[model samples]
Target: EDKTASDLFKHYQEIFPHGNRNAASHRWAHFVLQRSTQMTPGKVAYFFASFCPISGSPIDPTPQTAIRYESGHGLPQVSGGQAEGIIHHCCWPCICDSLKFLRVDTKTVSTSQGPHQFRFLVYGNPCTDPTRIPAEATDVTCSNGRLEASVLSDHGHVIVGMLQDNQPSIGASSREVLEA
Candidate 1:
């Protein structure tokens, strides 16, 4: 988001004057510029803080500070009859050095033709619960994360991998999943 046209142009120029920005190879260079926008809407239902699960660094800053994390991981868990988001310390620098996945989980299916292997789709988004922090690793806590999704205006507890995007309501055919 911080990148400006000049910053991108400089990096582009380094090779562009030598590499054609366009397909006008016969004339040495040709170019086309393009741009687009994306909108991912999320709201903070509540606000809370605690240490990052992965790095164990105390992150609930006194001044409510936030590290400029290039990215982070969220694991959703249920506690006290409520759903919670557990923040993993997957921020930039630590992410570069840490092991993102401990193991590869695969599902094997036997069909009439042969055995097919399918990978699990794990969708993890930033936690929207602001007031609840995950119990520390050693604090007798449930750190297991699972997927959860819901459509606009749906206030139901959705099971991961069960609901499709933009579903209008809960129904009997929730188990009918589509393959990606």
Candidate 2:
């Protein structure tokens, strides 16, 4: 049994066999967990929860893949009670495609001196937006006071580029090593 497969998941050995789950996957999960805890510094449990804030899908059980994000990064608070800050989790696909999740509004207003550009980042209703952000979907872009909506758009493009640079190997290898 892999030592990293904690006691919490011991009973599910068949689903997460020793050979399939590798060090890289564990390292990635740990890095995400640590970063998440550092950012929120509260509510660490949400980091490991199987829920994906973006797609609302159950994440892979073994060698879980997750991207952590803060709540105000672009998520709607229908109840109007959501704290601007809280950690949330989502899958890689959701993180990679986050630019689409946002609704950007820009208007140029005439000020006393000149035209001023106002940019707004709007969060769509989760039910209507095809791209939903996981509590984790905040992506690295919005962490540590990087809460600008432009960051979300720029970061998503960067993520896509990184994935493309890695290409078939990164995707195929992660599945082969992490999937049960």
Candidate 3:
């Protein structure tokens, strides 16, 4: 049977009583529909990474990590176990890149050990616009021959890869990584 938007909305409300019918929530619902229509049901995997000159403190250098994602459209809601597995499997490279990006420092610090003193900064959100880094997050600096990157969102566990200066690196992987 065909369902109207309102019908779907009502069904959703019944399923997610806690959901607020605000603009953002409505948009999110629409986004789900759009993504579902475009996607073919199948297993998928992805990976990402970045490098920075700074080094995280041995004690607590890594930044706080959080995964923001969504699953389910035509299919039943993903179980907690499934979601946990997806997050666990997908979050590593992103976290690693984030740590790498946060550690780059332009001004060199003198240490008792080495000529270059590298300190790691906590990774924050990712941004398409490099001009704006999340307020709580530090900027990824690439001066003095250093670069760093952090993962912001891997919503669908899609893989993305890109080449920078002819170096092959994983950008975002969606299906290819899973196949591998």
Model 1, 52-120: lDDT tens digits are 223423232222222211112322222112111222232444333222421112333333334433221
> Which residue pairs show collisions in model 2?
53-134, 54-132, 54-134, 69-136, 69-138, 88-135, 88-136, 89-136
Candidate 1 lDDT at 84 equals: 16
Question: How many clashes in each structure?
Answer: 7, 8, 15
Highest lDDT model number: 2
lDDT of 2 by residue, 74-171 (tens): 32222332222111224455553443443333333233334433222234222233244244433312334332222122212110101111122112
In terms of TM-score, the best-performing candidate is 2
> 14-69, model 3: which lDDT tens digit per residue?
32344432111212222232333232211000111121112111111112222212
Q: Which candidate would rank higher by TM-score, 2 or 3?
A: 2
Better of 1 and 3 by TM-score: 1
Give the TM-score comparing model 1 with the true structure, all chains together.
0.18
Whole-model lDDT values for every prediction: 0.22, 0.28, 0.23
Worst 10 residues of 2 by lDDT: 157-166
Superposed model 3: Cα runs more than 4 Å off: 26-31, 34-180
* Candidate 1 residue spans exceeding 4 A from truth: 1-50, 60-65, 69-93, 97-137, 140-180
For model 3, what is the C-alpha lDDT against the true structure?
Answer: 0.23
TM-score of model 3 vs. true structure: 0.17
